[model samples]
Target: GAGVSQSPSNKVTEKGKDVELRCDPISGHTALYWYRQSLGQGLEFLIYFQGNSAPDKSGLPSDRFSAERTGGSVSTLTIQRTQQEDSAVYLCASSLARSGETQYFGPGTRLLVL
Candidate 1:
């Protein structure tokens, strides 16, 4: 892809449902990441994957949140049994390197749990 792309820019779901958000990162990038931005909140790191390195999943809020990157390109974030507090923008970013370089962000998947 030319840039980071995320699907279902807006999602509305009832509590306790499951949702899957997708992300397509820029071509040739080696680092991919997922973050959450709640209303009036700062960007919170969720996970990060670098080429052949162990994925960093320390920021996931709970076990209900999970993600994976296949072939170092596309990635998916799955949220299970969602709750009202889960309503927020799920953003995906990618960088050319894994040393905290500047990250390009996707439009984001907006999840609304009511």
Candidate 2:
């Protein structure tokens, strides 16, 4: 991977539908993070994966939202039973360091839960 990027840049789905978002991080980046931006809601951390260590999933809004990073490369965010409130932009970033480093962000996946 060269730059951080997300798939399905825009998506529209009916309520209760399930959507899967994908993110590809930069090569050689050792840390990755996911974030969500919504109307009225600033920025919220969703999760983080550092190297081969266990991912920090505490930021996930609920059980309906889940993610996974494979082989320290690409990562996917799955949102089950999408709702109108779930309409937002999902962003992914990768850094060369675990913390306090420049993290390149993806363009983001715009998901619209109608």
Candidate 3:
């Protein structure tokens, strides 16, 4: 019955540091997705995982960005060598299936790189 949860609702980090953002999806949810949205910008898909299929990381901006889902529930986005451009809201969403389903979002983990 729990909704998605993200930690450190806000993160302030110096440029070039590595940061890990955590996500806890609702129970029994088999599809999860990560998206980044800059101020006033539309959501940019970063990565997604559905059941046992390989994750779709095509939208990951660069090699510095990566994510992993464990036990088919929790996921973490790790940004290596953080940059000022990476300052944005990292949102996590999940649904019962991968297609045609509304994604319920977390409050979001806002990253501010300085």
CA lDDT, every prediction? 0.93, 0.92, 0.94
Instruction: Kindly list the per-residue Cα lDDT of model 3 for residues 1-114, writing each as its tens digit.
Output: 788999879999999999999999988889999999997667899999998899999999999999999989999999999999999999999998846988899999999999
Clashes of 1: 0
Worst 10 residues of 1 by lDDT: 93-102
Q: What's the CA error at residue 8 for candidate 2, in Å? A: 0.8
Q: Candidate 2 — which residues are off by over 4 angstroms?
A: none
TM-score list, all predictions: 0.94, 0.95, 0.95
Alpha-carbon RMSD, each predicted model? 1.3, 1.2, 1.2
Residue 68 accuracy (lDDT) in model 3: 96
TM-score of 1: 0.94
* Clashes by residue pair, model 2: none
- Tell me how far the alpha carbon of residue 20 in candidate 3 is from the true structure, in angstroms, after superposition: 0.1
Residue pairs with backbone atoms closer than 3 Å in model 3 (clashes): none
Please report, as a residue range, the 10-residue window in candidate 2 with the lowest summed lDDT: 94-103
For all candidates, the clash counts are: 0, 0, 0
> Local error of candidate 1 at 54, Å?
1.5
Show where candidate 1 strays beyond 4 Å. Answer: none
